[model samples]
Target chain A: MAVAIAEARIGKWGERYYSGRVLQLLERGLIAFRSSTWMIVFSGFFEPVLYLLSFGYGIGKLLPTIDVGGETVKYAVFIAPALLATSAMNGAIYDSTMNVFFKLNHDRIYHGMLATSMGPLDVALGEISWALIRGLSYACAFMAVVAPLGLIPSMWGYLAIPAAVLIAFGFASIGMALTSYMKSFQQLEIINMFLLPMFLFSGSFYPLSVFPEWLQFTVNLFPLTHAINLVRGLCLGHINVALAGHAMYFVIMIICGLFFTTRRLNALFMK
Target chain B: MPESLIHARGLTKKFGDFVAVNGIDFDVHKGESFGLLGPNGAGKSTAMRMIGATSSRDAGVLTILGKDPDKHGPQIRAHLGVVPQQDNLDMQLSVSENLYIYGRYFGLPRAFVKGKIEELLTFAQLEEKRDAKVEALSGGMKRRLTIARALVSEPEILMLDEPTTGLDPQARHILWDRLFRLKEQGVTLLITTHFMDEAEQLCDRLIVMDKGSIMAEGSPASLIKDYSSKEVLEVRFGSDRNQELAEKLRTLCERIEELPDRILMYTEDGEALLGQIYASGMHPKTSLVRRSSLEDVFLRLTGRTLIE
Candidate 1:
């Protein structure tokens, strides 16, 4: 009798509750995640913290103080937000690209999922949200590492959680969108070619002002630069008009990336 | 007419310029077991995908459970159970977990799915292997688990494509028995296979297809009756001399099919045909007689063997 009731309800539940359907996708993702050991999750937390320890304290004594916005601050304070922004971007990109690519290709996980009540958009949104969850946890872990070193001083730093999620969403959606165009895992080298440049040139290691006049404009064009500037400005209590500009850039980026990702996934999977 | 659970009229599909399924028509009624019998590359799977609503038809109209698939894909799919030709199980998860997650995919509540897994494990005969990862199972077990996963939502129509193509004989019989139970329970089945014995055993009505077109459509027994004689006389005079002896024994039976290894004579009376062949002063190395089957139906319709 219960089986009949469930079967009867199956036909009545589709389309009206798309969120419930997408949530099913997230639930599936978590099921796969649970099958793995905890060692991978622990490792995601420590890589950024290890980088922070190496760069924040190991090199801070040499640089002494740095000027962020108008106020002078310890070198550790200036770099922590940049590290957080990059950490969020890296975590989101790796999850959305490598993990997603494996499931899309070798595992054919989405192929099986789509054969059910789920659609392509459900898969895209579900995977991007899970990547954001991973990115947010890593950002929080990075903050815990640097907070003991007295790096985060401003109350505006509390906004880091949402900011980290926004940055992660911007990168993760775009990464998923790019992966749909890929034919094989061999094309994944393109992601490395893209991210390595953005990581090195997006003002993660230094201020955009350090670049030459023409190079500074090019540096600001990168999404990570906007993420780093927005996050750094908030962490240091340096509120300014440029902060709104960076925030708007990511908002538009998130919308556009999500739009393209949904369309691309539909084409690749729904055929 | 009985209402069809699946209906397709002039349905077609193409990949680039190559036509995969070219303007085929078939209807599968509720509570009936229907099949598409064809060899490899005969466009059977493409038709299955379009019927399953995973692949849209290139042309024509399709309705599943009284709803157009183009407009209500997810809703239509909710009521469908598709066991694809390949088993795409999640290797990272356990057998019970695979069933649980698929139930959730249909928006079944967690508590309901948890209880459902125990019954499904027993149904698939995987109760001992419930906690085992999907990758650790044998091919037959994985296929059974896939079929069980498709049943989690209690679908109205179960589509199995080449369901027993890779299984051993015993495994095939086991899977067939499970599917037979589902049919007896009045679940509509849409199966595609190149195996004639499977079709004869399982399908109530089926279509013979070759190169993207239906050659003939009828029940298995009716098809064999329409396309072939009641019985077949098989005589193997060694591979080298079967062709030479086929001409000598032509008058003994109404029709004789000269294959490479054996000569098969189609006649109404197998015992009389075999005795007449023996009296023809030509002694073959071996002789036997049997009733005609779906294999003969397919061969008569398409001029090609079903197994390829």
Candidate 2:
């Protein structure tokens, strides 16, 4: 029974390399993510829940409620979906970027993995799979918190969980791709410099219409903008053909980012 | 049919115009230990990487397990085991987990891998430490675990790059004993190391490599006999007085080497050289006679110390 999988022979070396590596990574990734499960579930769900309770409800008492897409919504409803998107982006990028680099250069776990039948593609895919898994967990927890609060206005908001996963996959791929070029810990400061301003300015906390036209266009370039828009659109019970185009943006990013990341991993490890 | 597990003619590798491994030719027959012995920067590791099907050769015919590395790396590597220079053990996993995961990578079933992991942990002498994380283990333990992980798939050919480097005497002896046991089992082994003692102890036959090329190839005893004399007389005239001392002992020894710290007299009989030195009444400090070993043979052929 143990050798049954070995019966279906791998067609070629390069072809099976990624699949084998992913299998190894998936096993290890389970260990890594589950080890930190308590911290992940607590931080992801409560941070947003607290915001909905304190600022959205508590601070919302200070001002008049605004209308979003012809529907008068509470401040809690306004921020709930955006926070889910934020959690997805945060979980994916954190698990894939810094964690991936540390495992690659310092721990040399992948070096040991590479010595086996596993290849570079397996590493990239396994890492991305873990990132997606973490994204889903966070998204589910965030949505569960919001749904209990009666913040979600429509049934379509449930679909946002998988949508957030696709979005997180996009960000995680780019993050892993970027980590490949970093040679030192000092270089990681640049990742923060790039990620922090995107988090603040990508309309995570506010609507994009508040920004100037040129600034809004620039914010649209950030992946978080589309993710934020898609989730926000779903939670507010707003949908249209435009949301399809917005979701496609994340899909394109996923393909391009994965391609670049796999290529970069091959260049660094195979050499 | 007993065939050559490894066959190569002029295998070479270069990294961006820097020739890491110049064109080289060699072969490893079934179930034999082959070695590449050289100092640092001698391309020994690069050559092993090619045979392990991890690194691509620039311009030579190379086949490992009857398949080209470029085309059949995964298939060929499936039947091979590699122990790299540094112990690249998984820090997050326990000693047994390391072996279990490697077995899984070879597409082994979970049940089969569980049994193999237990067997390998015992073979590596890591059974007691099986549940401990690799980071908690000592250097020798980690290295042994790495070797154990390599054997998880029961590979046909095992490649060890500097198997006992940086190991203390006790650890090195333990590793050597394990390697000898593996050899006795008729597992084909290919190894690379700069330690002459290690080579003499573990290798049945070796090829001395230098500057990305093969300098000489033979058994340890044969190489020593061919390049070096039966005995060496160590004479210390003080580092400052080497030239004058050489002039004085010129006719006494067959050949002399003026080292930075001491002078060496290469002669067939050390007693004759000692008698001549005593007759001259030059009682220098520290004189001893010793049998020739692989270090002397390496120095004679490469014209440099192996350890630099």
Candidate 3:
């Protein structure tokens, strides 16, 4: 079974080199990730739940119900989408950036891989795919628990599985790109400097309108803000055409981030 | 002669203002152990990198498996295995896990790699440490694992860059034994090292490089025969008097090299040379006779020692 996945036949080498190679790379990663500690897989499922327990019921008891999707909803229902989005974001960011930096500079793991048939594109795509898997698992676990508590109101909330994947890919792509250029462990602080602000002000905690008009324009620029908007709209059953724009933000992130990431990875490895 | 697996004419590489590998020409034949023997700053590694299809040459024609590195790096590299100078084994991974990942990099099946890992662990003498994480092993163990990792793909040409640079004498002998086994299996080996004894032991034919250029190229015995004599007679007059004493002994042999502490007389007949020195009434603190080696050839060619 392991052999079959790793030995999937490939067609060509140049340009489309990543097509046949990504799965093997992903399989390699899953083996390493699984064999190591394994505490991560189970522990990762708890971050969102803790947030739900601590903030949802703790702060929810004090605040009155808020209107979402043209109907009054409990405070826990309003905050669940944000917790889910951030959890996915955190999972992907950790996998794509920190682990990547360790592999590239400290461990020199990818250097050994590059000596073989595998190219830089394979490394980038495979890492992002693994990150997406990690993000998706946490997203699913969070949803599974919250659904039992009657937090999910809309049948459309199931679409957040795919939505969480999109957010993970978008952030993981850019995170890997940023890490490709990092020279030292100190440079990793820059990723947090970029992520923490977006997490705090991306309308995950409050509505975008609550911020001033000028500040709302700035909040719209961050991808997580759009992610929160999409998941919130879906979970709250607020269906509209504007949701396409929010979804497009992540798509654009995927395209541009993957583009720059492949270029940077190729340059780093090739040079 | 066997067909050349790697061919180069005036190959060169530069990093900004510093030229790492100068325009040099050579051909690496199939199924023979070839070497680049040089000092620390020599271009052995840069040339090896181009041949491994990873680093592109700045100028001149270079081909690995008859394909240009610039255009077909991955394609050419697919058939080659490289053990870089430094050990870069994944620290967080088990020994077997390292082999598994490297095999998958070549797109090899997991079942095939799993089978190969057992044989490789035995070859590396690391079967006891197979399940241990890499960081927990000793340096020699890690170096062995690195070489074993490179072998997972069963490559056509195995390139080892200074394979035993930091290893102790015992570790180095074990590595050389493993490499000899690979050679017996008819795998083409390309090795680079600054150790004269290592070059003498492993290399069938080698190029002596200095300051990014080839100083001489031949079999180890041929290089010594060509550049040095059958035996060297060493005589130490005290360090303060060696300079004055060297002039008196200059005409006594085919050649003479005076160092800070002693004078070396190169001659086919060391006993004759030593008798002549004693007949002239020059007293030495200590002296010995030894066969000439690649280090003498390097000294003859570059006027500097191979290793400080």
Q: What is the TM-score of chain B alone in each candidate?
A: 0.98, 0.96, 0.97
TM-score each candidate. Answer: 0.93, 0.95, 0.94
lDDT per residue (tens digit) for residues A1-271 in model 2? 2223432445744563454556666777775455444575467657666766777877578743656777888777877888888878877877777887888788877776766666677778888988898889888878877798788989999999998898889888888888877898778778878877887888766677899999999999888888888998987769998789889998888888788888887677566
Expressed as tens digits, the lDDT of each residue in B1-308 for candidate 2 is 55788988887889887888888888888888888999999999999888876777889999876778786656677778889997777676678877887888777778889888878988999889988878899888888888888888888888999998888999999999999999999999999999998999988888899989888888888988898999998888687887677877877776777677777888888888898898987776788899887878788887787897
Per-residue lDDT tens digits of candidate 3, residues A1-271? Answer: 2223322433344432352567877777777777783677677788788878998888788875776556898989988998888888888899888889998888888788778776678888888999998888888889999988988888889988789999899899988888888888998998899888998899765677788889999988888888898888888778898788989988988888888888887666665
Interface C-alpha root-mean-square deviation, candidates in order: 3.6, 3.2, 4.9
Interface DockQ of candidate 2 = 0.47
The residue-by-residue lDDT of candidate 3 on B1-308, one tens digit each, is: 78998899999989899988899999988999999999998999989888876676899999877877786666677778899987778777799998888887777777898899999999899999988999899878888999999888888799999999888999999999999999999999999999999999999999999999999999999999999999998889888999988878987775999777778889998888888888989778898999999988998999888877
DockQ of prediction 3: 0.41
| Better candidate by DockQ, 1 or 3 | 1
CAPRI quality band, candidate 2: acceptable
Candidate with top lDDT is: 3
TM-score: the better of candidates 1 and 2: 2
Native contacts retained, all candidates in order: 0.56, 0.38, 0.49
lDDT of 1: 0.83
